[model samples]
Target: MAGFPAPQTPRGFGSGKTGMRTRTTRFGRTVVALMLREMASRYGRSPGGYVWAVMEPLGMILLLSIGFSLVMRSPALGNSFLLFYATGFLPFNLYQRLANTVGTSLPFSRNLLTYPAVSWFDAISARFVLNTMTQLLVSYVLMVGILVVIDSPVVLSFGPILFAFACAALLGLGVGLVNAVLFGLVPVWQPIYRILNRPLFLASGIILIYESMPPLAQDILWWNPLLHITGRAHEGFFAMYTPQYVVNAYPIGWGLVLTALGLLLLRRHHARILQNS
Candidate 1:
């Protein structure tokens, strides 16, 4: 006891209330910092920071419209195919981008785990949030551009659009999370993703309506949740379109199931999987 001195408090540990506040602030800062780091690494070096986010979907729309318009004899989708395609493409692209990117996030961020805040979920969530926001912004820009160029009487409806986006994000989140974990576990999952994502373009209601199909085919495609989401999204844009466009409880249920399973799997095996990698 002759020469001992009191220990000083660490930077972030203080009185209980102050410590809690400090932790909360640190957590928020970490998330935002990670998000910005990701956004910059992914898109900042390009000439425009976020314009490519809008351009990507817009370019796809233009190429698809032009190619389809040339091949098809008549515009079967009426005078508003631009609006129609925009509605479908936006959500579908969002789902695809999120799923594809998230699948690689775990493996990609393995090194970043040296930092305490950079958990697997944090990495996945950052990518998901960025892609989802970009999709929404791109969707709005595409809608305005369509209205201007095509002169289609674009109807604005928030309810179904919101629902459509929510479902799409949930669906994408579930699929992406599961896929991310799987890819981390099994190398073969990569090739499988490549093959599986290809069919969604045709299988989803992006290019064709289920109603346009024969009764038997329509019945079959109704099993796909992407179709239901896209169909419901279109209904929001076109008043003539109805909720009955397609029906599939599978996507909604499957989405929840997959997301829960993903969380469980990640919680149990994330550290081991990454450590082994």
Candidate 2:
């Protein structure tokens, strides 16, 4: 028998591309893989998994619309109440889901973090991507359903809706990253997060516009960036909708600032935290 050639080691095996590809490619691949993993784990096997994501929000909208229209006798939101609610509620849900999921991401992925290829950002990105996609799908389904049910004149304006969702995602991701880092630092942060996030549902412009409020109240609500996003989203869906609310540059600015800070913190401390855990 011919002597077997020495086993050839794979190129880049010890050169940082063995398990992980090159940095840029690896980062993209990791993010995408993590996103897929999350989708599969969370919503793949069950038939209702993905459908429920859309249905849950739609149900909330229907219930709220009926309650407001029949029981509360609230003024009509717009020609298409379901559409209006979809525009506002979907983005708000995205923000809330992203923030909540990301807040617990690090701890949630502690096991995966043992693998060198898996980074903290990968975990956070996975959750964010999953939540973002789910919310967008839900929004689209609700929008179409509303048009069919209510027969409202739906304008397919891409600009405002795109901007609104972008802003919402950015804001949510920034807050989530910060919260995740903090939670990784302090395990007790979960209870505090729950308390803080619960109040946000009411404060965020889910059911009403900020402009409809009194001056003082409007001034106060103006500080919330979600209000601006909801207003802009509604503007996209309904012709009559306009954002009269004053939103300072702070919330948007804070999103950028926090994201940067969170990334820096994650880069520096994430590995250590993983090792400690």
Candidate 3:
């Protein structure tokens, strides 16, 4: 046994190869394995499975639309409160869920990191791909169902809608990268971070449009990339609300900076994380 290869950690997963092709193959398989594991543990094992995804957000949207419609007699945006809230709520929810999923991915999969086949990159990448894909699908199906059922009088722009979803993914992934390291290193920061960010939904432009907000609030929230994403989504769906506030490059830039910094930290501290955990 000692003279043998000492039991490799599974070749397809990771073999510590130096060539680009080998490294790519290794990482690709690792990601797939992680994704499959994630799917099984999350959606596959649950009873409601994927339906739960669409239902939770759908319920909130209906309650808000109906409850507020009774009070204000109409939504702040379009005639259909469902469309207005869905347009904003879905994207914000996507960003929020992606951030939370990515943020805690390290701690959630810490045990997997002990294997030579699994890298820190693999862990985060798998979570990002899985969650982003899941959220995008949920948003699309839910939005289409609402639009078809209600048949609202709105001209949907495909380009802006796609762009908004992409931005939400990037912004969430960026924040998640940073939070992954923070939560892993500190452990105690999770709840504090949650508490601090608890008001994010209120500030993420879910309940109101950007144009309807106070000028000072607008200036302050202008820096929040999520606001830009939600604003862009509404711009895509609502024909009347063509928001001029979104600076196309801001979210991308912030996302890049944060993701780069977070990757750098993980590249440095990943080994220590596994050791400690």
Candidate 4:
């Protein structure tokens, strides 16, 4: 016993804390590796790479600004159509893109799932983290550019703006988790989900303010959690506007419920999904 290394604890038979730490480190590395792989595969191959990410939204905002400026004297909330649409479009776009990516996490990483180290949650998290950070950076750059170029008289309220981002991310993650399960389990669900989602752009207060809508439309659109998110976003950008229709609990409640449901379903069915894949 003097010279021999104290009976080396067999790998994975170590103390509880050591085991936990090993697992944690492993999970973190797995997630990071997956993130890097995605970045290379998704954006690295494209021409102009990440520039397209910012330009796509910027182009859309510019087109909207030019077209709207022709028909209307000013935006509904502010003098600059660029700022108004950017505020509404950016957060909504973040949710849409994030949800779409998160929804496909399982199938996208199906091949890797065969490995013991790669779990379904890890796949979802990698996509979520990568896309979320990319979108946030794009938003920041565009927002700063708009403020610099447009000279819009606007007050920046970080509280509501951050709240909007949080809600968008939560909703995206929650709905995405559910979609990932459904999309993987039921192939037909993808098309139907797309059809249902198409109306969200118009309905989410991106093109129309909540107050300006008819009473009947207001009553119905109020149920859309995204409408509340856009309203909250507008509140942060426009000092004069305060949307009473936005209920803080509505979006948060939907996000929490859907996230819980999605996680439960994924846990129950992930093995079957992997097998089928």
Which candidate has the top score in lDDT?
4
Q: Count backbone clashes in candidate 3.
A: 0
Give the runs in model 2 whose Cα sits over 4 Å from its true position. Answer: 1-21, 72-76, 246-251, 275-277
Per-residue accuracy of model 1 over 125-194 as CA lDDT, tens digit each: 7777777887777777888778798875667677778777778888888888888778878878879888
Deviation from truth (RMSD, Å), model 2: 6.3
Better of 2 and 3 by lDDT: 3
lDDT of 3 by residue, 1-277 (tens): 6777666677745534546677899999999999999898888877588899789889999998888888887777778888888988887887788889988777677888878889889999999999989888888898889989887566989888888888888888888888888877888888988998878788878887778899999989888887888888888987778779988898888888888988998889877765655
Model 1 quality (TM-score): 0.86
Model 2 residue 229 lDDT?
82
lDDT of 4: 0.91
Deviating ranges (above 4 Å) for candidate 3 = 1-18, 45-47
Error of 1 at 1 (Å): 38
lDDT of each: 0.78, 0.77, 0.84, 0.91
What is the TM-score of candidate 4? 0.93
User: lDDT, candidate 2, residue 40?
Assistant: 81
Tens digits of per-residue lDDT for model 2, 17-56: 6455568788888888877777787788777898888778
TM-score of 3: 0.89
Candidates ranked by TM-score: 4, 3, 1, 2
